[model samples]
Target chain A: MYEFLTGPMVWISFGIFFIGLIVRGVRYIRGLDWKLDRVTYGENISYGVRGAVRSILFWLFPYGTRSWRKNPWFTLWVFLMHFGILITPIFLLGHNILLKEKLGISLWTLPEAVADTMTVVVIVSVVFLILRRIALPEVRIITNWYDYVLLLIAVSPFLTGFLAYHRVADYYFWLMAHIISGHVLLIAVPLTKLSHFLLFFMTRAQLGMDYGIKRGGMKSKGMAW
Target chain B: MPEGTLCNKKTIDTKEQLQALLADKSGKEYYEQMNDLDVDRKALWGVIQKSLKSRTKTWLEICSHCGLCAESCFYYLANNRDPKQVPSYKIQETLGKLIARKADVDNAFMQKCMDWAYSKCTCCTRCGVYCPFGIDTGIMFSYLRGLLYGQGFVPWEMKIGSGMHRIFRAQMDITTEDWVDTCEWMAEEYEEDWPGLEIPVDKENADIIYTVNAREPKHYPEDIAEAAILFHVAGENWTVPSEGWEETSLAMFAGDWEAAKMQVESVYDAMDRLKPERMVVTECGHAYRATVIEGPYWAGLKTGKTPIDSLHYVEWVAEALRTGKLKIDPSKKIKEPVTYQDSCNYIRNGGLADVAREIMSYIAEDFREMTPNREHNFCCGGGGGLNGIGRYREQRNIGMKVKRDQILGTGAKLVIAPCHNCWDAIRDLEEVYKIGIRWSFLKPLLINMLEVPEHLKPKEE
Candidate 1:
């Protein structure tokens, strides 16, 4: 069970994540008739490209925008949580050790304490997000079971990984649970709201293209000083 | 005198003033008309299905409901940061659910969707600027409006305006004779100041075919006179068509593509007949956007193959000033520190923010800029035909708090709103908020400062 969870299941989850993304991307692209002539203000190809690039940069790094200042707490936690989520998975010493043991290839890994700290930060951020959904009346209205379930899905890998790393329970059992949770997250990434992981940059670029390229004679509102 | 000083004698409760305005006859009419419309669920869903294209579909799929766009909305801010007023929530509650459920919607749900789309949102697109996914909530809401329009559940003003356009070739229902007479009368009024001034109507092969909002002839004839005076002083050859003279497109606002097509086609046909070098839309934001940016596409005319180029009056004035064709006297510039309100269509959507500010600097001696000006400027609570839809008056006026504060912060006695809707919306804000600031259009200000050639100036006046 442990070998299957860590081996076949891992490959299966990776396949699902990548193949799901490809299918979604291809479907979206194929659905669009690329030749549809859009009547725009000014058709400057360079301007559109520049606008798309600008918007991509702005959204990827949203710290300076008005949205950041509006809700600094959400901004700070979200930034930290996203950073931790992306970083801890690839750069953690345990993950790197597994990569080296299995594939004979390894990337640089963070200090054990640092990895553990990041996992804690991510878990705390998810807790705050849940609380926010519950506490804020406005947010509470939009909150559904899916929102809570998604948050749980996001935090499970980190929480179980943290517990397993510290040997909180039966070492083999905890590690297997962590591996299974991570696989579930990987599989879910491309299938759910988690798809924003891949869709964010593309959507931002498309917006830049529409407002910047197709709508001619207009500066990119994203890049406007 | 130091800048940022309030010149008004009294303060008015803008909220109360707005409430009073909404309690008036037009407001009552809007409420009755909105409620009277029949709901056809299948037809409404059909419109939604038809309008759903790649861009809108992607927007629907990608919105994360982060609520980051809430701060960017004036309605959200003005209403004490209500999360329900957040732009995304509006989508979430209405369109999102419909798309999620794939058209299994009932009449009660459709009615709720209509109210949220029409009354709650102005489709301003300001929130789109701040949205992480760059989701244009405006475009999404516009599609929702298109669906609502299909169901024939539009605001009374839009219904009347589009109906008038279909029959009379003008939104305000001005007949050909009335349009021609109004132009002649306005020309005569301007002729009193500059003899030999000609407001040419349908002059064949003119350099410019100038068009105007119907409200100009119906209510603000002086704006027409101001444009004529400026054109005359600049020595440019411009003519207004007797037919299709109205540039405003209430049909576009109503999201009735068929009627919108007719409105644009009429303008194109009129311009094609005149064979003008270009068509110059007057200081109306939506009309300028419709005619210049969106019209050709709606009317199925290819951009390069189109007979006439479309230019906004702001762009035209800017170019005229740039080329020395139109001269302004520095000494005659507006005295009090004046601020400029960037019309959403002109600045954010059209990319004329810099040109507008340059024009403002040239004409106003003391030009103070409002905070978050230009593309980031708050809407005047009258965009997306909200000002025309009297049913949302209280909400619109309450939403004006953000803009009112922006103006008050500048302490500019006069606010120059180049777009007609912005001018009207800001004017209403002034009355309700009792901000005591006067509002003027760019045409009037340009007329005030224009340096008429010695031969054209009234002798010894």
Candidate 2:
């Protein structure tokens, strides 16, 4: 079970993630026709393309947009949550060692203490988001039972990884659970709302172009206001 | 239930009875059968499959429900931060889930969606300004409206308004002959004040073809006279197309694309026949949006430009003031503490925010700005054809609280609203809230302030 969880299972998860995202992207392009959807699909790379690049880059940073600026605490947690979850996987010492051993590839790895702390940060941030979902009427109204389930799906890998590293409640069992959760997270990315990781760029870019070219928004000339 | 009359809590008896109410030449208010209406799942899914393009489908898939769009909406703010008013929640609950659970929703569910889409939102796109992903759920709500419209759950006013456009080629019942007559009458009435002033119709090869809102001819003939007076003072070689003179599209508000397309094509046909160098639309926000920005897409014009270049009324008025085509009389300039309403359609959507400021500079001595003015300003709450709808009047009233506060914060005695919808919105706000503020359009102000060219004056006695 452990061998399957860490070996072919990893390849299967990555395969689905990559192939599913490419299919989603190509499908997005096929749905749009320039004449019907107008300038977003047009050849005006001048304003539309520039706006698309700027907007995608702009919203990625902390305090990047007006919306981000308005909710400072939420912004901090979101960035922290994203930074911890996304970066920890790539740079964790154990993951790096596994990658080097299996695929003859490795990047700089974080120290054990730092990796454990980052995993804690991801766990804490997920808790904050869940509490925010419950306490904030605005967030809670749109949230469904499945929203909480998605959150569980997101945080389970980090939680299980922390448990496995701490050698708590049967080390081998936790290690197996962590590997399975990681694979599940990877496989769920393109199939569910976790697709936001891929879609954020696509949506922000399209919206920027839509606003820039059609509504004379964002970086349009003489847009003093 | 459909175009003719509202189902105001009364059960409708028969289709003939509903058609009888619809027979009122002007749209009349009467309850029609809405008791346990059945959802046409086939038709609903048909529209979803055919029209739910990549942009909306992507937005539906990708909106993370972060709730950051709450404060960005005036409806949410005005309703004491009601969680339900949040743009993300509104769109997702109404349309988003519909897509997620397509063809499974019943009539009760769809009707609830229709109310939320029409009444709760103005489709202002202001929330998108704050959305981290720029997911304009307003666009989705519009799609939801199209879906609901297919299900025949539209608001009575919108249904009738689109019908008016379909039947009369205007939101009002006034015919083309009536519009032309009103223009001619206004020209004759104002002729003594400025001799030889005429609302020239169907003039070939004119430099600018001016289009106007039907509400002007239907109610305020003085507005037509005012535009003519301004054009005469500026020496603009402009003509009004007799056939496609009406520019505002309640059809656009109604989500009736066919009627909207038909209405736009009439004006486009005018541009073709008259061959004007430019088309100048009146001081109506949605009219400018419908004809210039969105209309081209509906018309499928490849250039994404109107056949002729088009300018909102403010853009033309600003240029006329800036280039010394028409000078503001310094003595006659407004001395009151005046603030300008940044209409969403023309200012945010149209990108004429600076043009409005330029106009204000030329005319007002004490001009105040709404905090977070121009593109980021709150909507007038009466846009998206909400002002005319009989149902949802209470929600409309509640929604204006934000605008009321914005104006009150400015402490300006008069508010200069350059668009027709803005004009109507603030006017209604004053009537209800008794804000003790006067609202106006640029035409009347320009007429009062312009230094009329000496040669064109009525040759003094």
Candidate with top lDDT is 2
* Residue range B1-461, candidate 2, lDDT tens digits: 32333543222234454455467433333323443556767777888888888877887776777899999999999999999899988887878778888778976787789789878999888988788767887777776776776666777777767767777778777888998999899999989989879899899999889999989999998999999888888888999998887788887887788778888999999999999999999999999989998888878887667889899998899889999988988999999899999988888787788888888889989999997788888899998888888788899999998999999999897999988888888999999999899988888888878788777778766
Give lDDT: candidate 1, residue B66: 68
- Clash count for each candidate, listed in order shown: 2, 1
> Could you tell me the TM-score of candidate 2?
0.93
Per-residue lDDT of A1-225 in model 2, one digit per residue for the tens?
888878888889999999999888888878876554555456556767766777787799998776788899899988998999899999988998899999999999888899888889888988999999999999999888778878888899999999988888899988888888888899888998788787888888887777667776532352321
Candidate 2: CAPRI quality band: medium
* lDDT, candidate 1, B132-153, per-residue tens: 7788787778777767666555
Pairs of residues at least 3 apart in sequence or in different chains that clash in candidate 2: B12-B33
Question: Which regions of candidate 2 deviate over 4 angstroms?
Answer: A33-40, A111-113, A222-225, B1-30
Q: How close is candidate 1 to the true structure, as a TM-score?
A: 0.90
Whole-model lDDT, model 2: 0.82
